[model samples]
Target chain A: MSHDAHVYSKSQTEYEYTRRVRREAMRGQVTTFAIMIFLTLIAFSAVAAGFSEYFIVPILLLLAAIQVVLQLYYFMHMSEKNHGMAAFFLYSGAILGFTLFLTFLTIVWWN
Target chain B: MDFNTKYTPQSWPDHPEQVTLEGKNKFLGFWLFLAGETVLFSSLFATYLALKNKGPSGMEFSTQTLFELPLVFVMTMILLTSSLTSVYAMYHMKNHNFKGMQTWLAITVILGIAFLCLEIYEFNHYVHLGFTYGQSAFSTAFFTLVGTHGLHVAIGLGWIILLLIRNAKRGFSLYNAPKYYTASLYWHFIDVVWVFIFTVVYLMGVVG
Candidate 1:
């Protein structure tokens, strides 16, 4: 309650501010957690539903991609404001990985 | 551990874990390591995709029979829920709630152990089903990719256990805050890889 307390000493206002940020972050986490579970369910049901392999494969991969992004940004806290370098390296690595895979798919053949 | 608790507003911010110099470096460096791990896993994933089902096509012990959806579903849920529990641990960390953080981390570690046991069972089941490694290129790739992931989970379990034991006495301080934070990040990365394994390796293996 003292205004002239130590500079780094926890003030009522600072406590409220931190609490509010954490509360909002928790909401984001809960929502994404539900969405991730839903996505996983959809992935499982798509297979169980016995659709054409052609139809199921791409859809399964797409859903997995979405879940990966969600896991990275939401649960992993990659979306936070100060994570620029992390995001850069992550996307760069992804792009490089995809490129390598694409090259193999284009060139590698089976008899 | 010489935890330097004193700080000014200029040094400590809303998030104490990330406000220190070492914390900032550790946070950035761990993510970069994870980025490289992404590439590593991707290469393994591509190898698996190319080699899956390439083994002479007529074997009775096909992937479909080998993959137990119910078991995989349970494993996925357990790992996913563990990720959430680690989030709660980090949440408590940000709030400076030491006991809350420790409780959630303990829960996370327990769930991780459960997942590892299930993986061991799954591998045992596969071997019993006569799908041992070296049967074919497909089998080799499958075991390597998934087994690597299982190894990561095992290592993560050990990492958490060591951190919990070492830090239990010290509690939350700036010196150890980044240590706990990075451990959670590693745990989350393991869960992320499992997401792909569940979908790409298990679900798609069953479907396609």
Candidate 2:
């Protein structure tokens, strides 16, 4: 609310440091968007050429995977050194997800 | 809705201690969500492949007969641009620029609506050519895959509208920041899903 820049006392310097760190955290979201744009164009081309359906599916899937990682690493900031254990729990869902897909596909295809 | 419950608190620290438990949990929770979404789409993708070659009356009325590139190209661009704008919004949020974030998010929302219109038009054109979803398994799969993604877009539009309205008065704080963050994540997630939908549903149908 104050028009003037609020100068921080040395004792309360952590608040200023926190604000700066938070600012850095936000800027990294841009890279995630850049990768998303690259992936989207590839998707558009696949839709355009009308020739790469089978090949394109996997490519797009891989890009989705990459974007997922991008979101986690950048936006979510989950890859910090202390959070390694938590990463396993997150990846466990990814493993379970793959299992679910393969199981459902097999049953449907075999039936 | 004032989301100020203890479970969903009124505010949180803009930056917390390095090993804060809550932030770690949130990060993992979102990852799990992305994983679940992956499985959801994979199942849809599998169903689509099974039905791709199955056309009407044993004759080939599948993707090749129905898919159009020009319209799809424009839709693709619309979605891609929306992704860029949402990123800009997030960038502003990081810098504590609430107005810039809102401005960008508004643009992203409009682009999302435009893409939805393009999809609707594309579907109508396909149906006019006798490629309706009820026509066959292929059409069923086609409609389900793409339609599900469309539904996501619709829901996202509604979600962003709520976010815009709710946050209009309240600027960027820790509580609202994560709310915006997750909403954008969902938006980007939908855009990514469409990428696959375009490939597996439209491209494959035309080629195979």
Query: What docking grade applies to model 2?
Result: incorrect
DockQ of each: 0.43, 0.22
lDDT of candidate 2 over A22-63, digit per residue (tens)? 556555655566776687577656656555456766765676
TM-score of candidate 1 versus the correct structure, residues matched by position:
0.92
Question: Which segments of candidate 1 are over 4 A away from where they belong?
Answer: A1-7, B6-12, B56-58
Model 1: per-residue Cα lDDT over A1-111, one tens digit each: 112223366677877776897889898899999999999999888888899999999998899889989988888888878889989988988898888777655555543
For B1-208, candidate 1 gives per-residue lDDT tens digits of: 1254544433344666576677888998988898898898888888888787767567666678678798999999999999999999989887777789899999999999999999998888888877889777888889999999999999988988998899897767778888888999899889889988998888888986
Root-mean-square deviation of every model: 3.9, 6.4
TM-score of each: 0.92, 0.73
Model 2 chain B is weakest, by summed lDDT over 10 consecutive residues, at B1-10
Q: Which consecutive 10 residues in model 1 chain B have the weakest lDDT in total? A: B1-10
Per-prediction TM-score of chain B? 0.92, 0.86
Highest DockQ model number: 1
Q: Weakest 10 consecutive residues, lDDT, candidate 2 chain A?
A: A1-10
